[model samples]
Target: MSSNAELHTLKQRTDNYAYVLRCRETGLCAVIDASEPDSVLELLARIDGRLSLILNTHHHPDHTAANPELVARTGAPVLAAPWSGHAGSGPDITLKDGDPIILGRLRGTVLATPGHTLSDLCFWFEADRLLFTGDTLFSMGCGRLFEGTARQMWASLTRLRALPADTLVLCGHDYTLGNIAFARSLDPHNAALLEWEATVRARKAVGALPPHPTLGLEARANPFLRADDPDIQKSLDMPGADPSDVFAEIRRRKDHFTA
Candidate 1:
């Protein structure tokens, strides 16, 4: 069966954020996170579809700054978590765990995968095999412990990893190269890290975008996710064999590394 739906992604480097557009051949379309309203509008204008809705992963300003303006422009419904405190006058739709939004030709299920923030929500498009991870799950790493616990974040990421192998991850930022750098420090012998870094550099040099909507299988090659690997545990001086613990310790190291 051929899908009439097509996914459009437009990224910006200023804050390393991205906005996604999902368009069905039925002249209807929806966007995920309007980080940059102007850029989003430009793309929307070019695409031959009706702007139907705006999907938000979290209440973070960087991710939602342009929501008001975009909503005004398109008169689309703003979908977010009930706890986000982001109810705009432009018609708010609060979503909870297990709540699915059925926009006629399009459908998306919401997951309360909090960790980066208490109100963080990730959306899973079963048909597209795409996960809008917001800031919780990054390219090679995960989000900071700003409003949630390491345990919570770990659990959230685990749930994401449990998805289908073909799922395409449309994360909030383009932190691939930077993440690979830290991955190398944590796992010096990881050939995958080296190769991934090389690929990132090549893309940047050519002024081309790195392959995003990263596949689930590729992330398993990431050291942050392979917390059970003996070499990774040894490098971090973490003695546990649990993947969750390994992931938590890696987060601490990354926080300290940045500090």
Candidate 2:
């Protein structure tokens, strides 16, 4: 199989799971979450387009640390949710639900996804069939239960999963290795997960990032997505209950994942 690079100036700095997206032809790019100062500037300088927008998935520093500096350097328009006050963002353009934007020749639309945070949003480039999942949804798992409930995250994941299967998911970070490791723990017997782990390990071994752009169907096989599946409830020592309740319990277990 061949690699298809979606955005021309797309680069991922795994330091804090931060990714940068810039349009090549226009010299106009949007930094998804700027973490490392030099790394982001290096990519920005290399790109032909001028920096026109800096977007923050949420107010996390690792994702927003370079926002002020990037904005100052390029005088680019900083766009973020209305409530993500002082993510070092101070975006000139505040985006809300259903807002459509034209970046260079690409059309970008905002989906007000608020599971990770009340103001978190995802950017969708319909023509290109690219969806930036941010911290909301990962290749194998979902975000933490920070400001929202399991129900909200569940709904958000469902909505995103509903997008066309071909929609390329450009999530915020490269947490694939770690996330898959956790997934393996829950369903150690899942052959699909075992096979995935082997491939991801090989990729990471070769210094190749393994942030899989998995289709919605592939994720369905993941126990994490089956937050409400009856089989999942059985594994969690519960059965015959509301899906939301099952989801909440699963999130509680995940909260203790790193521990």
Candidate 3:
């Protein structure tokens, strides 16, 4: 309630992050994704097993693989999108768009973001200005449209873009380096993109993943978020095209991008 929440970003084998959120006042905890049972168990042990909830951003195997094991171990109920295609036990709490999630004194709202999957959801803690974005919205790029349409993905991203500029984005994967390379290709002359690329390279050189960036930084440096920019549109050879059309072209190119 006071925005004094502790979030532990646990990196899994797939470069995916499983966020462990705890309320300082109540000692209540919840996890964002359960990629690995061992990792989740270890984290819960470190926190003295205070876990009370398990929420999945989507139903991808890599994201929801450990749900059943974790639920058996901690008895924490699973919360996921209503249309979730969970392979494990079904969700105990089916979350719809804009549903409220309560964890002790902390409260978060669920945002339906269909793109990578029709059931993708982003969890937003407004008081703390924190967002746990799944595959839908990444740092410098958005997720591939595996189930939904490019138009749907673009709309979903636009929704995220409307959030507070200072919101801290905790994306599901550590794909920043690759995404930055793609962003630089389109906006070669963007000073902000260049600066951010240097910082990202420095972090990787030391065997570290890029730090989570704020919404403000992403809005300026991320090509996917800046699909409406004249530079990106020109790069795609689609000047004056609908922003969603431009976004679709970018996503198509990214699908085959090696970098």
Best by TM-score: 3
Candidate 3 lDDT over residue span 61-86, tens digit each: 78888888888888989999865333
Roughly what TM-score does model 1 have, to 2 decimal places?
Answer: 0.89
Local distance difference test values of all predictions, in order: 0.74, 0.69, 0.86
195-233 in candidate 2: lDDT tens per residue?
A: 777887897799766645665534555565676677677
Report the alpha-carbon TM-score of model 2 versus the true structure: 0.86
TM-score of each: 0.89, 0.86, 0.95
- List ranges where model 3 is wrong by over 4 Å: 1-3, 83-86
Candidate 2 segments whose C-alpha is farther than 4 A from its true place: 1-15, 84-86
Off by over 4 Å in 1: 84-91, 213-215
Summarize candidate 1's per-residue lDDT along 39-96 as a digit string, tens digits: 8788777776567778888877777778888788989888888543454342288878
Candidate 1 — which pairs collide? none
Q: Considering only N, C-alpha and C atoms within 3 Å, which residue pairs clash in candidate 2?
A: 27-48, 27-49, 27-50, 28-49
